[model samples]
Target chain A: MQTTDISAAQQAMADESVKRLAMICWSNDLDKVWPTLILATTGAASGLEVDVFFTFWGLRVLQKNNKRFTGKNWMQKGESFVDRGGTDHLKLGKIHFAGMGTWMIRKLAKQYKVASPTELLEMALECGVRLHPCQMTMDLYGLSPEDFIDGLQPTLGAASFIDMAAKADITLFI
Target chain B: MAYPQDAAVQPPALRIDALGKKCPLPIIMLAQRIGEVPIGNVIEVLADDPATKTDVPAWCGLKSHEFVGAGELAPAPGWAFRIRRSY
Candidate 1:
């Protein structure tokens, strides 16, 4: 009887838990970032507890000075030059016409009344989506907490993120 | 088609025109303005974006609002979605 009662209590607790979505943002490409923000905002709007862990190049999305690169290595600096600018400077994955593709897409987005990446990011924040920066990645890139936009939670490691993701109903690596 | 409620008999308390707005904007506007009307009153949203068809209903379900139904808006090239504020 006690075992049955304990099982029932566990079931009840599970039923009352909030649904969660865990997303790992591993890319900073414009095409990739747009979908990440879209899904994050949509998930939050759908009443899911959403957490986004930004790592590697994904941390560029949160940079305050998007055009400037703080990397010490020449290769890292070259990458920063190629991918300069924050969310606004992201280029398309295919047929990129020396920044023209980005311009054309932005124009079409405006014409179609689609929200831009920046706007979607704002919406995601407003919707209460939790944003986390990978501490190890930040150290690799020499990024300080002050470099990121406001409202982000403290930088965390993969272990902590894994723990959170284990409890989530949905997990995606993007 | 039969609507969930007599939405035709009782006019919407507030109307939001989101004809040209795309995904997230129309739904965002609905979230912001649904509170303008009193409880139990309906709000009518006119939109052309295809996402609205699913987004509005999904939003209503998430917020616990009553999604009355959607119908074509004749004379205009758009759809009208009615949502009754439950809380």
Candidate 2:
């Protein structure tokens, strides 16, 4: 009886199922970008469905001039009420410096054969990684749709992203 | 050494041991190995961490790879997952 049960369990595990994940990314630190991509790509590679909602500085990863922007924005003077230090304040817990991280990603991409940010964005799309920018965040920052890359998906609100997250088997913040 | 005339063709293989590792490691290790496998091949991963149950499948979904399922190992130390590279 135990043997049979073990076999049954094994068989049950071997069955294929689609896992859903909704990732909420709010960091702009460039070093954190690859990990996010790596996680998303890995999930897709493993056959799970993924939705990525990027907000605030996180959009920089998809921006064309992301690498050009350095640490000191000089715009933090009066923005203490909102995120205090701008992108720097909202970076990932593991990575605190956006400038150094952005530089590292560009440097590493060049060192290896990995695609550029633009190419990576295309690759992400090709892999079926759904991307949604945060509407409220864009508006709060006074950013227009033209600020983002062409073909980028329209912005969504936190509620919309939350709705997706509610159904997801996994939700990540990076 | 002796050579067999009827040898079977086998795909490349990789083993990611993420036993006792944390949330992203299991997924990270699998990602590193997935890169080694050619498209249409399989990569095996052994992880004892509970987070892998969710992380591995989620990672697969993001990359379009086929998640082959994972479960507890009886009389053993960890769970094992099989991922087939589709791209």
C-alpha RMSD of each candidate structure in angstroms: 4.1, 11.6
After TM-score superposition, the amount by which residue B1's alpha carbon in candidate 2 deviates from its true location, in angstroms, is: 14
Those runs of model 2 whose alpha carbons end farther than 4 Å from true positions after fitting are A1-16, A66-109, A112-119, B1-87
Alpha carbon lDDT of residue A121, candidate 2?
A: 52
**What lDDT does each candidate get?**
0.84, 0.63
Model 1, span A62-106: residue lDDT tens: 776454775668876676677664677667877568878878998
For the second chain, the TM-scores of the candidates in order are 0.92, 0.79
Show model 1 residue runs off by greater than 4 Å.
Answer: A1-17, A65-67, A72-78, B1-5
Report the Cα lDDT for residue B14, model 2. Answer: 74
Top DockQ: which candidate number? 1
State each candidate's chain A TM-score. Answer: 0.84, 0.64
